[model samples]
Target: MARNSGRVGDLPPPPEPLAVPAVDAHCHLDLMDASVDEAIAAALAVGITRMVTVGIDLPTSRWQAEIAAAHPEVRAAVAIHPNEAAAGVDEATFEALTALARADGVVAVGETGLDYYRTPPEQHAAQQESFRRHIAIAKDTGRALMIHDREAHEDTLRILAEEGAPERVVFHAFSGDAEMAKVCADAGYVMSFAGNVTFKNAEALREAAAVAPQDLLLVETDAPYLTPVPWRGRPGGPYLVPLTLRLLAQTRGTAVDEFAAAIAANAERTFGPW
Candidate 1:
C-alpha cells in the first residue's frame, strides 16, 4: 500500500514574518505516533527551526539520541522520569544514559526529578534515589539538568540544592507555587512554562511567569500533551509555540515579538545553539 503522507487536520497559519527562529524546549516528538519526518515537516511549516526531544527511560533515552543524530534541528535530554524512576534504574541503565549524555547532540540530563503526585509511597524512596543518580550524572558531566517536579516541590528543591546541580538547571513544565518559584528563582534556575500556564485556572502559573527573572524565563509546548489555549484542540507541535509565547508575552507585559526573541535566545543559552 502506498504510504499516507502529510499531517492530518488543517495546519495552523504560519507565523508572520516567516523567519522567526523558535526552539521548543521540551517535546516527546519520538512518542507522537506520527513519523518524525512528518512532525518535523509540520513544525518547519510553522517556523520552528529547532526542538529538544526529551526521554523518560533507558530505551526511550537511546531513541532520543538517535532522533537527535538523525535530525540536525533536534537535540536530546536523557533520564528516567520520576514516575518511571520507581522501577529503580539499574547500573547499566545509568551508564547507558551517561554515555548518551556525553554523545554529540545530547544537551541535558533529564525530565528527571520528583513527581510525588502519581508515584506511590511504596516506590517513593527508589524515586528519590534514582533522582540523585541522575543529578550526579548532571554534575559530573556538566550537562544541564532538566527537572520534572510535580507536587514534590520541597523535596525537589532540597535534592537539587543538596546535589549541587550545575548552573544550567532547567525546570521543565515548572508548576511550582509562588514560594517555590521564589526558591528556584533565587537559585537562578531556568523555569520553563508550558501550555499549563495558559489554562483558565492557571493564575498562579501566570503570576510565576510574571515574576520569573527576565533572563531565566523559557517556554515549551510539552507538545502532544499540554497544547496551549487557542490551539488546545489542535495537535501539538513547535509551531504552536507562538500561541504560548503570546500568552506569556501578554502576562509579562511585553511585546510578542520581543518576548519571542528573548525566548529563542534563552533556549539557545539553555540547550545550546541549534
Candidate 2:
C-alpha cells in the first residue's frame, strides 16, 4: 500500500483517546511506518489496548505471526489477499499459507475472498478458487475466517454457503449496504467496518452501521489506507483508531464508552483474547 507523499505531515495528530479500552480488530501494522513497539505504545496511550495486524501474503503473514509472538498486545490474521489470489494462488501456495494459519498467535485465516472491483472477469475463477481454499483452511484450523469482500458480495456469500462457512467469519472493511448487512447479520457474520464508514458519501454504509446488531459490530483502521475523516489523506496508524470508533458509535446512536466496550468484547470473541 502507498503512503501519502506529504511526509510526516501526512500522519494525523492522534485524536483524543477513547478512555475506554478498545481493540482495532483489523489492521495492517506491517504496512505502517511505525515499529511494532512504537505502534503498541501509541495505541496503549490512546486506550487502543490491542491490535490485530493482518497479512496480505505469505511472507507478511509469517511476519504477522512473529510479531504477535513477540508482542502480547498484538495478534495476527494471515492469508493471500483477494487481488493477489486473482493473480494465481496455486495449491503449493495455499499449503504454505495453511501452515501459517495454524501457527501460534495467529487467530484467523483471512483478508481472503472475492474482489471484483480490481480483478477483471477473466481472473474471477482463480479468485473464487483461492477463496474456497482459504475457507477450507480457516475451518481446518478452527480459526475465524476473515473476508475481503469488495463488489463481489453475492458470490462471496454464495461461496461461504456452498463451502459451509467456518463458525466465525468477518467481513473486513465491510462494503455492503443495509440489505447485505441484514444478510450478514442473519447469517451470523461479523462486519468489521474500517475508517471509510465515516465518509459523507457512505450513507448506505452508515445505514448498515445503524441497523447492525451491536454484538456483531467491530472496528478497524485498515491503516495506511482508509484513514478516517478529518484525518483523511493522512497516513493512519493504530493510535488513530479513536476517530473511527467515535464515528461508528455516533452513527449507531450509542455512547462512546459503551460502544468501545462492545467492540473490545467482539474483538476478543473473533480473534480470541489479546
Candidate 3:
C-alpha cells in the first residue's frame, strides 16, 4: 500500500452544462492561447453556443473567416480596428475585409469605430474615414455593424448618423455616460454591456443597463479581457457569462432567466441563429 502512495494524474472533469442561452456578442477567441477547437468546446460546455470573433486587421479578419468556416458555432466580424487604422490601413486591406464580410458565416462588419485613447488627432481623419468605409460595407453587404467606441462617443455617434449606418448597429462594450446611452437608445441602437458594468464605480453603467430598452439589451464577456466581478481578478471565457448575466439581471430588476432569454433572442435578431 505504501508503494502505491504516489499521486496519479487526475481525470478531467465532465464539461459543465450550459446555463442560460448566451451568445458572446463580441470576443477575440482566435487570439486566445487555446486552439480554436478547444475554445469552441469550452464555450459550448458553458452554454455559450454562439460567438462573434472580430478582426482588428486584414490578416486577423482572414483568420476569423477561417475560424467561422471550421466551427459552426463561431461567426466572423470583419473590420479594421481604429488603432490599426492609424498605422495606415491600405485600400487592399479594406478590399480584403469587404470580401470576408460577404463570406458565408460572416455576421457583421465591425469591432470597428473610434478609439481616441490609442489614436492621435493627427490620424483622426483616417480613423473616421476608415469607420465610414466600414459602415458603407455593412450597408452594402447587409451585415450588422459592431462599433467600438472609447473616449470618442461624440464623433462616433455623429459619424454613424451622418454616414447612414445600417439598421443593425451595436455599440460593443458600451463605455458611455447615461446621456450617451440615451442618445444611442433614441437612435434605436443596441448597447452590449461587458463585465465593466459590474465594477464598483460603474454606477452610470448600471443605470444605463437598467434604462436600456428590453429588446436592445445584450451581454458579452469580451473575454480574455474585462472579466466580470466574482470572476473579476481571474482569466475569463464564455464560462463566465453567467456572472455577467446575473449582474445585468439584478441591475435591470428582472429574473436572470428572463434576462438570459431576452439576450439570446436579441442575438438571434441581430446576428441570426447559428
Candidate 4:
C-alpha cells in the first residue's frame, strides 16, 4: 500500500504554501513513505496544519489511533475499507474498531462505504454489510463518517440513506460528476476532493468541484496515491495539498485565500477542531 515503499525520497517539491492554513481532510500516514514526524512537518510548512489519518484494516486502524495519540496535529479515522471488507469483518475486528471509534483524537469512522471498482460481484454483499455496520459505529460514537465511494455511487448513497448517516459525512477523494455533486450538495454532505481532481482527464471531477457549494468543499492528498498533476506519478504526502486547493479555487473562480479559508472551516466543521 506504500507507494514510497517505507522510505521517503524527494517528493515533488511542495507547491506554494497557502496564505490561509488548510487541513488534509483524508490521508494515510501509515502507508506513506515519510516518517510520521516528517509528514507532519512537511504539511505544516505548506499550511496543511492538521491531518485525519484513516485506516483500512484492523492493524492500520490501530496505527491510526496510535499516530493521533502521539501527534497533536493529527486526528484518527478508523474503519475497515470496503476493499478490505471483501475478506469479511469478524467479531474481533468489529469490536476493536468500535472501541477505536470512541478513542480520544479519533474523529471519524471511515475510508469506508463501497468500492465496486476492484471488488467482484460475489463480494458486493459483504462490502455493503460492512458499510452498514460502520455507519452504525459512526452514529453510536457521534463521530464523523468518512466514505470511500469508488464506482459505486448509487449503492453508497442508498446504504447511507437506509442506515442513516452520521451528523457529519465526507466523501473522501470524491469521484463524482456535477449531477452527483448536486445530490451530495442537497444531502448536506461534505465532498473532499483530492489531487486527482487536477488531472487533465478528470473534467467530470473538475465540474463537480465547480458546482459544489463552498461550505461542502474539502481537499486531501489521499496520499500516497493520486498525487496532484505536474507531479502525478510521484509518491505523495500531505504537503502537496496546495496544488489541489489552488486548482479547485481557480476552477470555481474564487479567490485563493477566501477559498482556502472556507475549506479550512469545512474541515473543522466536519472533523471538529484539530
Off by over 4 Å in 3: 1-19
lDDT of 4 at 117: 95
- Clash count, one per candidate: 0, 0, 0, 0
Q: Tell me how far candidate 2 lies from the true structure as C-alpha RMSD in angstroms.
A: 1.9
lDDT of 1: 0.82
Better of 1 and 2 by lDDT: 2
lDDT of 1 by residue, 41-103 (tens): 777776677889899898888888888998998999999999998868789888888888998
- List TM-score per model, in order: 0.92, 0.96, 0.91, 0.97
Q: List the lowest-lDDT window of 10 residues for candidate 2.
A: 1-10
| Alpha-carbon shift of residue 147 in model 1 (angstroms) | 0.5
Per-residue lDDT over 1-274 for candidate 3, one digit per residue giving the tens place of the 0 to 100 score? 0011122222123233545777888887765545677767877786778888888888778888888988899998889999988766788888878888999999999889999998889999999999999999999899999999999999999999899979899999999877888889899899999988998989999988888898998888776677777555455666567677788898889987788889989999999888
Give stretches of model 2 more than 4 Å off: 1-9
**True-structure Cα RMSD, model 3:** 6.8
Q: Rank the candidates by TM-score, best first.
A: 4, 2, 1, 3
What TM value does model 4 have? Answer: 0.97
Alpha-carbon local distance difference test for all models: 0.82, 0.89, 0.82, 0.92
Error of 1 at 37 (Å): 1.8
lDDT of 4 by residue, 16-103 (tens): 9989999899999977787898899999999999999989998898888988999999999999999999878898888889998999
Q: After superposition, how far is residue 106 of candidate 1 from its true place, in Å?
A: 0.3
